[model samples]
Target: MAVFLTLVLGSLAARATLADTWPAAIACGLALMFTLTGIAHFVPGMRRDMIAIVPPPLPAPALLVTVTGVLELMGAVGVVYPPTRADAAGCLFVLMLAMFPANIYAARMPDPPASMTANLGLRSAEEAVYLAAAIVVAVRGGQ
Candidate 1:
């Protein structure tokens, strides 16, 4: 997901533009993506899967999970505004880093669901991609 996001945004950014609309589009896409994912997290069976990904010691951290989801949703919404998109992307990057522990935990845990391993590897790569995208957006967004 992150990798895909990065690729899409990077491709868009490579072009010359007279307006900031490209960055705006990138921000809007990211915001929508995160907002939708956050919504999915609250669906009935989804919570358990999320808990499983977190460290065992934090298994029941419902509040923390909810807060993170809200933040993700908010960040996405915030990114759509031209005045806030760059900062919002930066915020999203920090959020991405903050939530990475859960992914690492899931990857290292013994025998996660059959699909978990593949998902973890994919997400790890995705994170790298998103990081690069965020950097690009941050550096070139205001131009």
Candidate 2:
């Protein structure tokens, strides 16, 4: 199932024109990001990086990181599930929206990371990707 979904979406990403390509790129990006992050959950440096990216008000950074990792994994899995791709896309959309504040916070804070500005732009691009994926899912009657 995973292989088939990846192939179909991957092909779409590679061959589709701009209109069709955006959503496929978004889906591929979301899938790859989730799969990688899911693996990174167990890495010490990545765990810390995740913590830093999340906002200050959030307590127990480790726990939040774990939860986020789990959600990403689930969403990635759902994206490959023919019965649940849309639901997964919706979940990802909400997750992206929920995390936007943290990205903005990181971008605007004084003494932010050297990459913070770029990270913010990347995060916005990611959000746009999700929105594009959502539109694709809707148009195709995903799930």
Candidate 3:
């Protein structure tokens, strides 16, 4: 829900305040979404939830979370800069793919996080939308 809301509201705001193009709006939305999610990595409770979602086999979940968070922040910045928008969107697309397994793992757990408790199908659909948005931003954003 957070992702959807962030993307929709951010895009709308961007459309109103920034460029009128859909690509520009999506780029802004993606940046805002990544910024929020990246910041969550440093928040105690959200950090715990993120770490918990990492598959058990991954060593040093905390470190991994921090690294991904930094990457997300970097992507956010890169996405908004015209010169780097495509590359950043491509990286974010890959990042989302790479991180999906953890989401699946979290959803399958007997007691999933409140955020992850949404049905797996719903989560997958949301991820698909996010990926599509990234692709749109990559292909047409900042043009």
Identify the candidate with maximal TM-score: 3
Give candidate 2's error at residue 127 in angstroms.
Answer: 2.2
lDDT of 2 at 90: 79
Q: After best superposition, candidate 1 residue 49: deviation in angstroms? A: 0.6
Across 53-125, the per-residue lDDT of candidate 2 in tens digits comes to 6788888878987887798788878765657766777787787678677678777676665434436676676
Clashing residue pair totals per candidate (backbone < 3 A): 2, 0, 0
Q: For model 2, what is the alpha-carbon lDDT of residue 119? A: 60
Q: Cα-based RMSD of the predictions, in order?
A: 3.8, 6.0, 1.1
Compared with the true structure, model 2 gives a TM-score of 0.70
Say which prediction, candidate 1 or candidate 2, comes out ahead on lDDT. 1
Arrange candidates, best lDDT first: 3, 1, 2
- After superposition, which runs of candidate 2 have C-alpha atoms over 4 Å from their true positions? 1-29, 113-122, 138-143
Q: What local lDDT does model 1 show for residue 1?
A: 51
TM-score preference between candidates 1 and 3, better one: 3
TM-score versus the correct structure, for each prediction: 0.76, 0.70, 0.95
Reference-based lDDT, each prediction:
0.67, 0.64, 0.90
Which numbered prediction scores highest in lDDT against the true structure? 3
- Candidate 2 lDDT score relative to the true structure: 0.64
Writing each residue's lDDT as its tens digit, candidate 3 over 1-78 gives: 897889889999999998679888889999999999899889898899899999999999999999999999999999
lDDT of 1 by residue, 55-104 (tens): 76764567767888888878766766667777878888898898888888
